[model samples]
Target: MIEEPKTGMNIIVKTVTRLTTGLILLFGIYIVFHGHILSEGGFAGGVVIALSFIHLMLAYGREIVLKKMSEKVSELLGNIGAVIFIIIAVLGLFTGGYLFFDFFGKGKPFNLFSAGLMPLYNIAISLIVGAGLFTVFVTLVFFRSEKK
Candidate 1:
């Protein structure tokens, strides 16, 4: 027998998923881009993105493979992205006079993927943080055993 969805369920689920997804993506994009300006860019952004994904999962009941994939991809991108940022700083430290100093040797922020790899670092951290949250949520929410 097919269990018909309650009238309000669809509305509730759709509204929640759409809003969560949009907010996450928006904030994620904002953080990813702004890493150059602020200190914690990619990692923070990725975490925001992941939290948003979890909200979607809860609202939509896991019928969101595309959304899930997007979340996974975001995590990956964030990790690599943020790592590059740290690497850039380390490289600068080695070659340049000071730590995390890219202005002297590398091209300015205007150049291609410039900013001394700050953007990349933001992406990497964002992904890792987001993924970490996702993993925790899944373990607690899904794999968690309910006590009768």
Candidate 2:
């Protein structure tokens, strides 16, 4: 019987990535589940959720893979997600007629489904973050490595 070579990561890196990814997912679930109670806001919660996977990449990604992932799409998407958050904040100007208004607060703390367009931004952040991590990992694994 033939055995397959490891895809990329060493045993320790793979183990670390698995553990970190699991923990991050747990933390993200915690934040998303209770974001309203804490009043930390959904967008922030979404970012926290997204960052959890990023931690995995940083911990376990191969050197070449990490460099490539860090340099390109991951970085681009990270910045874009950041910009999206800013844009969401800027959108408040239109809704509140000023910056950082209640934005459908209606004088009461909103539930998970309560926040107006804030949820939309939250979803967007989640998309960017998840995609950023996925992109980095997929690219790194599939990318052809140049011989040193």
Candidate 3:
């Protein structure tokens, strides 16, 4: 008797992906939040976050991953991130006479809230990077190469 093909990877891989996906996502978020105090920043953290979703797509199928985060949603998120970043810059310009000026108060040194607008910038950047990369990945996955 012939068996049907599986849509995604084998059960072992799927189980491992299921276990590790959340941890990857959390680690990315941690990197984004602690970037000012630590070495890693939004760009690094955003790549990690995007990797988590890509991991899911690789372990599962595109359909399953797309169900969780559709291309439209990813694009929308990226646009929203850009808008938020711009808004913050505009607010800073109006308040401090320069674009992206640190208008917020700088709290205690070595503290989580010490960076003024830096943390907010990191969050926005993470959103932009994560969504943009994910969208690109999806588009590449759907791209079809024609045979000569």
Clash counts for all predictions: 16, 0, 0
TM-scores for every candidate against the unseen true structure: 0.62, 0.47, 0.91
Q: What is each predicted model's overall lDDT from 0 to 1?
A: 0.66, 0.60, 0.91
* Pairwise TM-score winner, candidates 1 and 3: 3
- Give the Å error, residue 88, model 1: 6.1
**Candidate 3: which stretches are off by over 4 Å?**
1-5, 143-148
Q: Per-residue lDDT of 50-85 in model 1, one digit per residue for the tens? A: 777777766666546435564456456546656775
Of the two candidates 1 and 2, the one with more favorable lDDT, higher being better, is 1
Rank candidates by TM-score, best first: 3, 1, 2
Ranking by lDDT: 3, 1, 2
lDDT of 2 at 78: 65
- Write down the TM-score for model 2: 0.47
State the lDDT of candidate 3 residue by residue for 1-148, as single tens digits: 4354378888788889999999999999999999999998999999999999999999888889889999999999999989999999999999989998898899898998887999989999999999999999888776443242
The runs of at least 3 residues in candidate 2 whose Cα sits more than 4 Å from the true structure, single-residue gaps closed, are: 1-20, 29-33, 39-70, 105-110, 115-148
State in Å the error of residue 45, model 1: 0.9
- Model 3, position 44, has a per-residue lDDT of 95
Residue 15 deviation, candidate 2, in Å? 4.8
Candidate 2 on 42-83: residue-level lDDT in tens?
A: 455556655665565555544544564454666677678778
Q: What is the lDDT of residue 64 in candidate 2?
A: 45
